[model samples]
Target: MKDRKYNTTEKQQTRKTIQRNVNSEKINSKENKANNEKVLDNKKILIISLVVVVTFITILIVTGVFDSGVQQNVTQMNTESQNSTVNMANMQEINNLENKIAANPEDMESTLHLAHLLQDSGLFEKAVTNYKNYLIKNPANADARVDMAICYYNLNDYNTAIAEMENALKYQPKHQIAHLNLGIVNLTARNMEASKEWFKKTVEIDPNSDAGKRAQELLTSH
Candidate 1:
């Protein structure tokens, strides 16, 4: 009887050990499952955050905020390229005219052409030299004198511009362009009264001409 009881007690202890191990495994499995779910939730949150960032960038692209700047840069580049091309062509023409005039120093036509080109190219001193050369033989050319006056005006020599314009008027008393340009030059030189007088003369010359209409506008505004 004592041996049987001892065996039964040993068996009971073994069963209790088994039961404890099974319960510990259940708790560990529950903890593992919870940890996996937490990891999945974190991954989902990260994916959603990435999606939000991508969507925001897409919206910005669609709104033209980025495209406008790119278009403006392209437009500016194209304009600069066109201006450079035009300058190159003008320089070539100037060189050709210079060569022609050098071969025939008395070529007043080439001299005037070169002067016009140089004035347009903003070489005021060189243009003045060519204009003086042309005027020495063609002093009665009111148009040429007016053009030279414009060169002086651009050089900021307001007094010389005025005198040149007046000389042009001496050749062509009704030179509307000369009068209008004198008004512009006087305005730049801060001689408002002289500017107004020139503008009035321009209008009196021909009220329907472009220069006269421009002078009229200036008189009304100033």
Candidate 2:
């Protein structure tokens, strides 16, 4: 009986050892599966991040926003360069005309050209001087008289402007430009009635002329 009791105790100890081993195996398996799932989630997150970065880069390239901005800057620079070049050329031409007038004081063409250039450059006093010198040589030149009148008007000499314009009309009664210039001078002097009369005369003389069109526009505006 003693031997049988010892054998039974040994068998019970063996069974407990086997059960402990099985439980340890099940816990290890659960741990391994959880680790694998975490690794898969990390890989998916990495892939999504890479895709978003690539898509953003592609959108920037496809839209051409950066390229268009560069092109616009280049075009603006080119336009400024061209304008500078043209201004330099115009100044050189003005210098040449001035030299011509200085050497030959009797050069009517050079005087007229310089006067026009000075007027365009806003040098009203210099333009008036040249115009007056040209007029002294050919007093009956209605166009030159009108040009001088415009110069006088720019110089704020309202009376001189009006007199010169009226003198231009004396040379040619149907001088549309003279009439238009007279109207403009009178308007500047606040003589609305006189201005209207000159404008009316300009329209009646030549309805299809540019001066007539300007007169009509002024009449309608007033």
Candidate 3:
């Protein structure tokens, strides 16, 4: 009987030992699963952060925030090229006009045309030379004389401009444009009284004319 009791007790102790070992393994498995899930979550967060950074950079590019400087440079270069081409064309036309005038010194029509063209092109000194030559032959041309005076005004020779405009008036008194231009020149020269007088005369000459209306406006404003 004692031997049987001892064997039974030993078997029970061995079963308890095995049961405890199984429970310990179950707990270890639970802990290992939780640790693996945490690692996966961290990896997901890292991937999402990388995606957000890349998306922000792409948006900046698409919105032109980084490309504005390049666009400006391209636009400026195109404008410069166009302006250069236009200047070259204008210079060519001027050269042709000079050649024509040089070939025929006595062609008054061509000479006057060249003078007007040169004045339009802002070659004031050269235009004055041509105008002087033309006026010597056609001194009674009030229009051309006024135009030459305007060139003198542009050249800032106020005294000469005033003198030439007066000469135009002597040829054609009551010339509205000459009067208006004299007003303009006098105003630029700070001769307020002379400017007012000329403006008044321009209006008195012909109130319905363009120059007269312009003169009236100047008188009212100034």
Task: Output the number of the lDDT-best candidate.
Answer: 1
The superposed Cα distance between candidate 2 and the true structure at residue 156, in angstroms, equals: 3.1
On TM-score, the leading prediction is 1
lDDT of 1 by residue, 160-222 (tens): 999999999999998899999999999999999999999999999999999999999999999
Off by over 4 Å in 3: 1-86
> Which candidate, 1 or 2, has the higher TM-score?
1
The ten-residue window of minimal lDDT in model 3 covers 86-95
Error of 1 at 24 (Å): 12
lDDT of 3 by residue, 1-222 (tens): 999999999999999999999989999899999999999999999999999999998998999977987888999999999988877876787788778878988888887888887888788888899999999999999989998998999999999999999999999997999999999999999999999999999999999999999999999999
TM-score of 3: 0.67
Model 2's C-alpha root-mean-square deviation from the true structure amounts to 6.6
lDDT tens digits, residue span 20-72, model 2: 99889889889998999999999999999999999998888789877788998
Looking at model 3, residue 40 earns an lDDT score of 96
By TM-score, the better pick of 2 and 3 is: 3
TM-scores of the models, in the given order? 0.77, 0.65, 0.67
Using TM-score as the measure, name the better of candidate 1 and candidate 3: 1
